[model samples]
Target: MTRTRTALLCAAALLATTLQTTTATTAAARHEQRCADTSDTRRGEARRVMDIVREAHRDLGLKAALVRVTTDGREVVTGAVGESMAGVPAGTDMHFRIGSVGIAYMGTVLLQLVDEQRVGLDDPVSRWLPDLPHGDEITLRMLGSSTSGLHDYVTDPDFLAQLDAAPFRQWTPRELVAFPLRHPLWYQPGTNWSYSHANFVLLGLALEKITGTPLERLLDERVMDPLDLRETRNSFTPQIPQPVLHAYDDERGTYEESTFWNPSWTTAPGAVLTGDICDLARSARAIGAGELLSRRSYRVQLDPGTVGLPGPTDTCPADVCLPQTEEFHFGVGVIVVNGWVVQNPSFSGFAAVQAYLPSERLAIAVSTTVDQDGASGNTAQRIAERIADALAPEQPLGG
Candidate 1:
């Protein structure tokens, strides 16, 4: 071929290469746009779920946030509605204490120690914590299952009053444990099931005693780090950040601001590091996948504790109850309701619901800054049910 003809052929090759590069770039952009569209669709679905709850519930005066993440590596959706209070700013990214839901995290830590053979779930409390009057009768399993006969300290008016009066006061686990220690047993250990935060408080102290490390450190090293949860941290001081939302007690005739309180005293018992809806949904999904515990330890968690509450609703089977579990009825630390296990409502500035269908690998998390009442639980249930229904349209809500 002549020089001019060869040069023309080279130009053709260069033009084809450029066209291919442009085609690939366009295809990449389209893929990203499609992913964004899917994310927005899921986010919109989540927002609509929250709207249904907001419009339907009148009493809660609720400000709600929700996040649903599917196992297909999709955040799907996250959005907030309502105000932190009647006249306050609209609630968004505000930290709400996850209340007893934190217990499940504590339960995970306890099981981690059990996995190491450092502690036995059924070992008598007397084996490690010998200071209590009835330590011999109580076992670590009972503590996790709420069958230890330990009274909940939150119900003690005097004790609560003391904490309320000095809500920011730094309290040691021993100081917090004293209240339950003063109360007599509700029954012999391993017999009855009750919702007692004190059991986990004792578990936290036991963790400290056995490991010579604070509960917060264990949480960071074991759970938080592995999960890559940045916002979650144990706070036992008044130095908690300022952007936190304040809560209210609507039980009174007039709605009163419950005040901007610190969680210094409730650490381990109720003090969990707080995070956004997305983070919580991720945590819920991780826990449901049994990524945090061994298979045998996971079995221990699912072993139901006892049946203490009113049986399942008429809409569901009789065996299905809240905090659903198998062995002791409590199912480790979570409640089994309608065969669906769940953690209690967090009572701090907000209430939290984290529920997942293990078979489906679908999880929903609802967090709200709202007043407590039937309304609070009802709203959460409705929103959670909607997400679950969307994911599992065949499964009916509880009767």
Candidate 2:
């Protein structure tokens, strides 16, 4: 997931624990089965990518990390470093929370519906959620592109305090959006751009209402199933399915287990998910190529800025808004960085980046964890950029 404003402020406010030895062994076996592949012909490239992962794991003091890359959706390279637990080595099969990547999935589903005439990107949300504030003015396109101007609940001080006080508390969608609804919009709907968890939450509600199907089912049918992302699934409780990568962080003074921390506050009920590195790599390619979307829908999803109406006030800040440029811009559920489509999510001691260079048909996915105090939250993204630079030096992964 893209970093929330509160996550940036509370960078040091995030750790892991001992698990049964049997559990570790089981996880290792399952990981091997899920990640096994023999088609890798780019040994030299794989070694180069592993060097980046190993160096990052040591230099950044990460508890564990994994990277997977594919060229032209055929030649594959995967690597891992450190441990999932105390003695359990990290593997490509181990699952970890993939925060904002879910947003990209939701956006893809919305565009698919648009292509099918099941929904319209410009349709006011009032058509689905009539009681929501300014629902009539906000459109699906605005929500998908984070241009709805809705206040980001994650930036609310009270919400941050509550989250720190009870890291394991499960939050409902209504409760999460209520924090933002209590405050006035940051700017008029469809006017300014700011990354808001509330926007995606509302998008989930609208999608459910429009299709009369659960969000999880809709994602499975529309995205996961078609792409064959077997490792991806929704989480209702704090539980991450087995073969897990234990995450550790020292944000709370002592390094402690944060692998199972409640993520219900992160996104919609069925969209919060954990997956293996392979799935992340696959998703990068599928989303970047927009294989399931029509040409028109793909174009809009890649550049929704065309529909974004600027507000009278300049509320665009460096943290929330990256000024539009030839090399950088926010797309529907995705970020374009130096012409490469990317999505990076960070939360609760886990950070990950999935980047795809459509020109080269290359996909790079990296997931990381921190164990040191005051560590930067963008560790995984930084590592992914290093690997991309090595593989696709012609197209630098720009800020």
Candidate 3:
């Protein structure tokens, strides 16, 4: 989940309380999580990982690089490199906005509800949002699979212009959905593949209405609670918790700290989330493994019929309507590359990636912020792919 035009999920086993805890309380929670994995003595691997991180941090001019690598739920390495502010060092446990991790969580929630028979993936969302234009033609499956054909509001020129003009604006869900509706459907619903934040935003709304639960509580109960992500949490404001790993960007033609920039337009409101690297890796494991869904639902989560959607059409640009293939494609909210499931979110100077190789039970999570005048991009993703290549060369990860 990223802002392709600009920039671009969960609680513990909450899918969490509002993460307004004092610094000490958050530390205690982190300690408890660390105590659960005490047998991780992979020094050799850890050293290798540290070297990789150091090289990336330096090469990419990252202000801070927070990372966690785990094998079968055991820590292989966890670290933070560089500074959080002028002279303050960043810590591994510092919390950062998880970006599109919420997308995966939202998708997971959809499947969890599906597994419980609360709703069918094929059920039309018109069942809930009766007034949604073309709701009858758009199925929950299409929404979660990003085949809904709705234009990604994040890519709309007007949306980006507004965002650029007012980075601190508190955007409403209806406002975000309005951007896509302003344009005709990208293609017939469910007949093509395109990454649209509108799909997830709409899904979040429909889900809330379907269960009479807010997206925050719904995700915590169904997804985060089961995963036990103590550090993961939802925030109503742009306020990231203490020991925050601050982010910087030059997108506005000025290098500045974007740590508190309102990210409401990124996705649905209640679903915006933040967490530490450890929780990020844990999230990769849970969502990638489909740990909370039934076997049938898990299988569907991995491949929800997007394996070979028709290629980009005239109405759909090739870059926007990405090609879906076996090695690389969209699966629900996650992106599948080789055999790794990934969610990479980059926006407002913060970039992160959580990737899991289900077959190997290996997970890699990385988050980074740019230094003043640093090269700008999703550097975190490039780092994770490199790590995946090093750890599982036989089954390389990436597009």
**Candidate that beats the other on lDDT, 1 or 3, i.e. the better one:** 3
Candidate 1 displacement at residue 96 in angstroms: 2.5
Question: Candidate 1: global Cα-lDDT?
Answer: 0.63
Candidate 2 segments exceeding 4 Å error: 1-40, 306-318
Query: Between 1 and 3, whose TM-score is larger?
Result: 3
Instruction: Tell me the tens digit of each residue's lDDT in model 2 across 1-399.
Output: 357877765664431123456567776676566566657478888888888888888888788888989887764677789888888898777889998899999999999899999888999999999999899899999999888878888889999989988999999889999998997777777666778999999898888999999999999999889988988999888888777888876656677889988999998878998888989998999999888899998888889863344433555555664345557767889988887988999988999999999999999999998865635777999898888889889898858
Off by over 4 Å in 1: 1-50, 56-59, 69-73, 85-92, 164-166, 238-243, 251-254, 265-271, 304-329, 371-382, 393-399
List the candidates' TM-scores in order. Answer: 0.76, 0.89, 0.92
Candidate 2: give the clashing pairs: 1-100, 1-345, 15-249, 15-256, 15-257, 15-258, 16-256, 16-257
- List, residue by residue over 13-123, the lDDT tens digit for candidate 3: 122344444546867675556734568578988888889989998988889898899988888888888999989998887889997899898988888888778999999
> Each candidate's lDDT (Cα)?
0.63, 0.84, 0.86
Clashes of each: 25, 8, 19
Candidate 2 all-Cα RMSD: 10.2
User: Could you say which candidate leads in lDDT?
Assistant: 3
Q: Write the per-residue lDDT of candidate 1 for residues 1-71, one digit (tens) a residue.
A: 69999999999999999998988677546433432324435655556665655564444556544444454
